[model samples]
Target: MQTAKRLFFSLDRQTECVADYIEPDRYSFLEQLPENERYIPRGAGLSYVAASFGSKSISLGLSKFNRILAFEPSGEEPTIVVEAGISLHKLHLFLCPQGLRVPVEPGHPQISIGGCIAFNVFGKNQFREGFFESCVEEIELFHPQKGLLTCSRNENTTLFELTIGGMGLTGVIVKAKLRLKRIPSPWLNVQKIPFTDLHHMFQVMKNESQTADSLHSFNDFTSFGKGLGRGFVYAAAFSEEDTAPELLMTFKSLERKPTRRFALFNRLTIPAFNAAYRTLNTRLKPYERMPFYRFNYPIAEMSFYFDWYGRKGFVERQMLVPEAKLDPYIEKFEALLRKYRPQIVFGSCKFFSGKQCHLRFAGTGIVISMEVMPNAANQGFHDALDELNVHMGAIDNIAKDSRVTKDLIASEYPEYGKFRDLLAEYDPHRQLASALSDKLCL
Candidate 1:
């Protein structure tokens, strides 16, 4: 019912568009659309690239569809049926009161559940519980051509898999039934382990995988030469008896601030900052218990974390390499980091297991994610990344990929052609499309 110019931009503030129309409504929103008009569904707009941007078509905004249709707190198989527009943070608040929680906790808490499913997002504990899709019991999708269709493992199996990591290209996800886990307390028993090098870190990660419920490692990318791979590894699990007094303490959310036009992170600033950060970590206690929000969603607490990248913003590059190739691949990757010396603001390491969906970014390997600030002078950084992808046989995470080509995707994801065929069958007329789909020729 609203008529206004809609400007869509990615999280990194790199790609943007001014769309003709943006309709925000209930399930019937698709019915009013004009025939043969292309549109892309939007959630929290968390994709690092232009996946949800519609330059020449309508951008279907689903924020108004926020509603919880059903809630089952106590049962053998507890579940919650929620509208796609509901943010994960809201859902967490709702579930925490009932002593239940969703296992998959992506870093961004404000992201909508629909966006999480579209990306099949990975969590800190992906090494144990798998991607967010693993918690999905069923979904309700509205196809422009086919109308409403319910999909799950028991029915419409193919659509279920496709929609899980389909990047909203398959259809408009209206509702979803997510499985929930019962927790004794909303806190985590955290253990901070520091490592001097890549080999030591990987060894610790492998050893901790068997006992830890969640694991994530921070790398000091600014460090060069002998101190190259020095950083901290965090292993944590939900507290059972509220035994740690530190975990009971509440921490206020950090103040929100507007992004400044000036740059906060440059080549010189990053090295010095990282050096200090590493030193500060060394002074902290090896073990500490903190609230669940502090351990799982720390970045969410800092509302202005992304603003540090400045107005030019940054691109997030993520790739997954098999476990067998982890050692050598990381060694060479470190060399590339030294050669390019791109201004890296944030970096993390995670382990992933279980079978990967056709389009989902999951596998039995290690995932390396880095946020880099690029300028006109850093053209070689892009080339070096492309070469590294080829050399390491890395799989491109569709959500974070900006420079990946169709050929590179085909070379890396062999199941991509089959996924395309399935998408064609479901949306034969191509009623659903996005900038990402068009860029990778999906």
Candidate 2:
């Protein structure tokens, strides 16, 4: 009875779209409703830019579909069956104690299992492993046309391939059987490396990635021209709990920080923090103790990091350039940055081995993502970046914008047209999207 139109909120209110929230436990309620052909189910609504968006009838929030459902504790498979709406944070808890981990997790734990699969997400270990889709054992797809169907690598191989990173366009991922990674312990042994400049940072990452079990960088290109590549790299690997395990905090204990406290003060913190933050040398810094949850995506602390960008909303531009172009791309991007002085506030480079993901963005190359805080002062600079396709020209690469217009977006990822075609065939009526979906032609 609760329709998405009655209770909806767009991820970015500036965009015109309303999601119909639905609890995972209420399956019967949805089944009873008139089936919508174009409806796309979404979780978390954390897809800041709109990757999981729909045009006509958006399937609302499904994060409550959070049941452990089934798991093979000692079975030969070593896998777990979970409802798609579970958060990555919760999923990690179930796996950690058994010396297991997720093969792919985005930069933040706030994302849901369904979101990860829809994006066919990737992570720090991508250089060696590849996208998150490789580890998924199977998925239960819900489509109005097909009704309820099973899709997996072994069974619905074509659909399975298309679903992973297909951006939820193929079908609604109701449940998934994900293969878990065995580990020695839930703890992580991580090292923080702060570079004084861009060259030093790139030089170190290329070298360390060869051995670091998993690596991620927290870098700033904001000063690229004025020497802004100075930043830190946090590389971590699963280790036998070397540190005291008391640092781990449970979900019930974790709470959202007060954003209101920083509202008036962030104007000063942005520049001041970056100044001191850029000067510190990371090499001299040694390894430190860290919890697995904290180590992977620590930025969870600054929840409002993106929203802090005032009126001129910021866009996160991400791409994967061949390793050989790592330094070249940095040089070229920085050159463009210096020319534009656009805010490259926060960025990261995670190594990956090449492979075609369903939506196809992360791959065997250098994966760089930046938080672009554009304003009246930086519009010209940001516009230049929107026009720069140099990386695609120099290397086998692609760029993705969760909020980008359909025309510009499809142009960036040629395979997107193919992706849309698959989506159309699967859901012919188009009852599952929001306004953004219609505008993007997805």
- The most accurate candidate by lDDT is 1
Off by over 4 Å in 2: 4-16, 52-55, 75-77, 224-226, 241-246, 250-268, 278-285, 304-307, 310-313, 390-403
lDDT of 1 by residue, 1-442 (tens): 6646766666676767787557567566576666677878888777787887667656777777778889988787789999998887778778876778787978766778898898898789998888899899999998777788999999999999899989888888999999998877877888888998777888888899999889988888776688776788898878898843323223233222234577788878888887777667656666777777667777765656777776677878888888878888878887887887776777788878877658778788888788878676556876776777767777878798676778878877768899999988877887778878888787
lDDT at residue 128 of model 2 (Cα atoms): 59
- Candidate 1, residue 156: CA error in Å? 1.3
How far residue 440's Cα lies from its native spot in candidate 2, in Å, is 2.7
Model 2 CA lDDT for position 78: 77
Off by over 4 Å in 1: 21-23, 243-260
Evaluated at residue 167, the lDDT of candidate 2 is: 63
Total colliding residue pairs, candidate 2: 22
Error of 1 at 7 (Å): 1.8
Taking the tens digit of each residue's C-alpha lDDT, what string does model 2 give over 1-442? Answer: 5554533323332333444544445666556546644566777766654555444564656776888888876755578899899888888867776667777777677778888887667777777567778778889987655666788867988888887766666667888898877767657777787676666776777788877777877676644445576677777777764534434544321222223232222344655656655455344445766677776766656655544654344556676666666666667677777877665566676667775543566545666777665446666755565555533532222223444666565655657687778767766665566554566686
